[model samples]
Target: MSAHIHAQNKTTEMERNVLLIEEQGSFAVGGKRIVKDGNFDLTNPLQPDGQTYHGDHAYVFYQVPPKARKYPLFFLHGAGQSKKTWETTADGREGFQNIFLRKGFGVYLLDQPRRGEAGRSTVEETIKATPDEQFWFTQFRIGNYPDYFPNVQFPKDEASLAQFYRQMTPNTGAFDGKVITDAVSQLFDKIGEGILVTHSQGGGPGWFTAIKNDKVKAVVAYEPYSSFVFPEGELPEPIQSTGLFGALKGVEIPLSDFEKLTKIPIVVYYGDNIAKEPTQVWNKDHWRSGLEMARLWAKAVNKHGGDATVIHLPEIGIHGNTHFPFSDLNNREVADHLAAWLREKSLD
Candidate 1:
C-alpha cells in the first residue's frame, strides 16, 4: 500500500486488541540529597528553615507486555520534551509506546533530570515564558510557521498544532550531559539489559549511557541534534553553521570508552526537509549539520569494526516525515521499518 493510503487508513474497522501487560510501574533514579542549613521558626510563616531535598533524578514509566521480548526499549526524549513524546501523537493516534508494546517489546519512557516529572533540581534556573512556539514549529520541520509542508505527515489542523505546542516543556535546571548520562546509566543498572532508543538531544546522553553501562545492548537514534561523539585525537573539524545555530563540534571520548559504542549495533535516522547542503536558513541548517555528522560518525564506527547504519527516510522512499517520525501520521510504517531492522540484527 502507498504511504498515503496507509496513513488514511490508520484506524481500522476491526478493533485493536486490548493490550495485555505482565507488569507496569514507575520509578525514579539517580539523585543527590542537599541540606540547606538554617534555624527554623515554626511559628513564623516566613522564616529561613533547614531542610533536606532529594533532587537531580530521572523519572521512568515502563510496561512489560505478556511474553515480552528479550530486550526492552528505553526511550529518551529530546530538549523541550518529556516522556509524553512517546505516548500519544498530536493527532491522538497511538504513539511508539503502544506501537512497540503491541509487538511484545517492553517499553521504558524517561523524563530526564530537570524536566517534566523529574523537575526537582539541586540547582535553580529561571524559566522565562518565551514566545518561541513558531520557531520550534519551523525547526521541527512541520513547515515554516502557519504553513504545513506539502503532504507532510504531521497533523495540520489547528487543534493538533495546539496539542503539539502544549507538549513543549522547560527545564527547571541546566542541561548537564553528565547528569543525564549518570541517571540513565543508573536506570540501566536497575532494568538490566535493554535497547536504548533516543530522539534529538537525548542522543548525546544516550551514547554516554551506553558507554557507562554495558546493559545498553543496541542503540536507535532519531535526528540526533549536534551531539555526535568521536574518539580522542580523532575528532573532525567542526561543521560550521549557516545560521544562528552554532558550529557543530564533535565531543571527544577516550578511545577506550569509544570502543564500547562499537560493541552494539547502532542506527541513526533522519526525516525529510533537511537540506542536502548547507543553507542560510537556520532550521534547515540545523538538520543539515546533523545529517552530515551522522554519516561521519557512522563511518568512524565502521572503521573500528562497529555496526552502524544511517537511514534518511526519504532516501528509502518514505517521504514527508518531520523530526518526530515515530509519532507522525504514518508512525506504524516507521515502527515497522524499525522492527525489520531489529529482526535483521537479531535484536528482536
Candidate 2:
C-alpha cells in the first residue's frame, strides 16, 4: 500500500505507481570511550557502552515519480512537529506532497532528529521541559478558547483539535544550532541539489542549510519564527537575530552572508490576520515582531543583490489563511499560488 498506483500519461510516460522509498538512519559524530565503574562488576569486559556521539536521526521518506522534476523538494517541519506536517491537511485533504507529486516533482519528507520517527537523542539531556497543548494552541495561532480568530481555519471541535495535537511531538525548547545545521547539511549531501520548504521554526535551520550547502537551489519558508535579516551595523533584537544564521552556530547572521543568498531565490509566506484588525490574540504579544523583522530582512537581502520576497497572503487577496497554510482547507489553492511562483523562478 505504500506504493501508490496511478495511470501513466501518454506523452511523458511517467510510471504509474508512486514509488516510495523509506530510509531510516543515524548520522553520528564524535567518539566512543570506555569508562570504569567504582564497583568493578564487569559482566561484559568488551562493553563499549560509554559513547559521546551526538547527532541527528533522519527518517527520510521519498515519494518519487518515474519522470520526476529536475530538483526534488525537501520538507522540513517546525519545532514540535513532524514530517507529517506536509503529508495531509488538518481537515483530511491532500497536502503539498501529493500536490507536488502531481506537478512532476519528487518529495522528501524528514522527521527531524529527536522527533517523530527520529526518536530520542542524548541532546535531550540539555532540555529541561516541553510545552503543553495550550502553549501550542496559542503560539501556533489556532485559537485561545473564546477569543479565536474571526475566520479561524484550524479545526475547532474537540475531535479535530485532538487530531492536531497528535501531530505535536515533544521537543526541548532549546535548539542546538550546530546540531540541526549539521543534520540538514547531511541531508543535502544525500540529495545533492533541491528546493527546501520549511515551516515555522524550520526556517532558521533551512536558511543555514541552504547557505552551507550550495546545492540548495531555493527556499520557501512559511511562518519561520526565526528571522534572518537585520540592519547592517545595528545589532538585531532577540527574535530577529537570535537563532541560527547560516553555518554560524547560535549567532546572528553577519552582513556579509547576505551576498551568499543571492545564489538562490528566497520566498517567505505569511498568512493573513498577522497584524490586521480583530488581531489574533497572540499576534501583538509574539508573532508580529518576527514578521516585521522578516520584512526588513527581505529588504536587506534584495538590497544586497539577493532574490528575496516576503508575501503577505491577505495583500494578494488570499485571506483567512493561518500560520500553517499547507494544512488549511484551501491548501490546494495556496499550493497553486506557490507553484506559480516557483515556475516564475524556473524551479518548476
Candidate 3:
C-alpha cells in the first residue's frame, strides 16, 4: 500500500471488551458487551491512520481533578504492546488511570507510530515474520521479577495467545522522538506543564524526543530501551542482531546530542530488578543499550543542572521487566511511588 493511503487508514477501535472468568464471566470493549467465555483482541493493536512502525502519532487525553481541569501527562506503552497495556487492570495493580490520576496528573496516553493499531505491518516486516506466523512470546520471566513485566496471560479471556503480533518496528527508525515531543509541547502549552512518562520500548523514543523539545519539562521513563554504550569499540550486542547490524552501523548519535537538544527537567525509572550484565547479554542484553541511554541522559541532565534524576524501584524487583514496567506483582507500589515522585517534581 502507498504511504499516503496507509497513513490515512489508521483505525480507532475503542470497544469495551468483556473478559469471561475462567469459571464464568465476561468483558467489554468501550462499553460493548463481550460474551462470557468468548475471546477477542480487546486492543485493535494497529493505528487507525495506517501509519506503521513508529510512523503514526496522536494525542490521548485524560482530565485530572478540579472539575474538568487537565494536567496533561503523556502515557506510553512498551514495545510489542499497545497503550492498552497501560490501561488493562491486572490482578493487583491499577492501570495508569489510578496511578497517575490519583496523583493529580491528567493522563495523555500515546499510540506510538507502529505500536497498537499503528504498528501492525511495520513490526511484522521488521522481524521478517510471516503475518500468520505465531510470534513466540515468553512470559516466564515474570515469575522472576515484577508483575508489570508482560505479566498478563496471552490470548486472554479465552482468545488465542498468538492473536497478538510482534512489531517489526526498528528501535531507531528515521522517526525521531521529535514527532512526539512536538505533540506534547503543544499539549503542555494548552494543558500546562505535566509529567511525561514512558514504559519499555516507549522509553527510548521518549528520551530521543524529550531531549529535542523544551516543552516536555519532565519525564518518568520506566526502563526505556537503552541504546547506549559500545564495548570498548566493539558494537553493543543488540545492535549486532540479525536485524540491527546494518541499521545501527555508522550511526552514533551520542546522548550528549540529546542533552544539547532538550535541557528540560526529567527522571528515569530504571528496573533495578532487571540486570544488564554481559553474561546475560544474549537475551537480556537490551539493558546494555538502556543503561547506556540512561548514562547519556544522566550526563546531559547533570550538566544542565538538577534537571533530571534516575530512580530505581527495587521492591518492583529485577527480573525480565524490560518491555513492560508496571507489571511486577508489587508494581502498584512502584506506580504509587512514581506518582508521589511526580507530585514533587515541578515540570515548570
Candidate 4:
C-alpha cells in the first residue's frame, strides 16, 4: 500500500482504540536555588526584600501508552517555542505526540529553561514586543509575508495562520547552551535510556546531552539550525551568511566526547524551499548555510565511523513542506516515515 493510505489506516485504527495511555504526568528538573539578601517591608510591595527563588529548570510532560515500545522519544523544541510544538497543530490536527503515542511509544515533551512553564531564570532578560510574525512566516518557509508557497502543506486558512503566530514565545533569559544541555542530561538520567528528538535550535543541546549522558540511544533532528557540533580539530569553516543573517558556525567538542555520538544512530531532516545555492534573501540564505553545515557535520560523523544520515524531503519526492513539517497538514505521512526509520533502527 502507498504511504498515504497506510497513514490513513493508522489514524483510523488510533481513533478507534489503539491510543491507550497507561501513565501520564509532568515534572521539572535541573534547577538551582538562589537567595537574595535584603530587608522586607509589607507596607511597600515594591521595596527591596530578601527572598528565595528556584529557577533555570527544564519542564517535561510525558505520556506512556499501555504497551509502550522499549525506548521513549524525548522531544525538545526550537528557539522561541515550548512543549506546545509537539501538541496540537495550528490546523487543529493531532500532532506528533499523539501520532507516536498511537504507535505505542512513550512521548516526553519538554519546555526548556526560561521558556513556557520553565520561564523563571537566574538572570533576567527583557522581552520586548517584536512585530516579526510576517518575517517568521517567510523564515519558516511557509511563504513570503502575506502569502504562502503554492500548494504548501501548511494550513492556509487565516485562523490557522493566526494560531501559528500565537505559538511563538520569548525567552525570559539569554540563550545558554550549557544550561540547556545540563538540564537535558539530568532529564536523561531521570528517564533512563531513550531517543533524543530535537527541532531547530534544540539540536545543539540535544547533541551535547547525548555526549553528556549514556542514556541517549538515538537522535532524530528536524531542520536543526547553526549549532552542529564537531570534534575540536575537525571543525569545518563557518558558512558565511548574506544580508542580516549571521554566519553558521560549527561548535567544537573534544574528540572523545564527539565519538560518543557514534555509538548511536543519527538522522537529520530538512524541509522544502531551501535555496540550492547562495542567496541574498535572509530566510533562504540562513537555511542554505544550515543545510550545507548539516551535510558537512554528517560527513565528519561518518568519517569517525558514526552512523549519520541527512535527508531533504523534497529530494525524496515529498513536497511543499515548511520548517515545521512535523506539524504540517501532511504530518501523518511525515510521522510514518519516522516510524519506519525507528523500526529499521530497532528502536521501536
The C-alpha stretches of model 3 lying farther than 4 A from their native spots are 1-55, 59-61, 67-70, 90-93, 114-186, 226-262, 304-306, 315-322, 346-348
Q: What is the C-alpha lDDT of each candidate?
A: 0.90, 0.70, 0.46, 0.89
Local accuracy of candidate 3 as per-residue lDDT tens digits, 9-35: 321111122221112111111101122
Clash pairs, model 4 backbone: none
Reference-based TM-score of each model: 0.92, 0.80, 0.58, 0.92
Ranking by TM-score: 1, 4, 2, 3
lDDT of 2 at 335: 90
Worst 10 residues of 4 by lDDT: 7-16
- Candidate 4, residues 1-348, lDDT tens digits: the string is 697587667656875675778999999998778876886667875754676788999999999986568999999999889999998999899999998998878999999999999998999899899788888898898987777888689987899999998888889999898899989989989989999999999999999998999899999999998678899989898999772568888999899999998889999999888888988777777888999999999999999999999999899988888999899988988998999999899998
Alpha-carbon lDDT of model 3: 0.46
The local distance difference test score of model 1 is 0.90
- Per-residue lDDT of candidate 2, residues 220-294 (tens digit): 999876546443574444542222231121235666665667779999998865654223344433556557667
Best by lDDT: 1
TM-score of 3: 0.58
- lDDT of residue 340 for candidate 4: 92
Better candidate by lDDT, 1 or 4 = 1
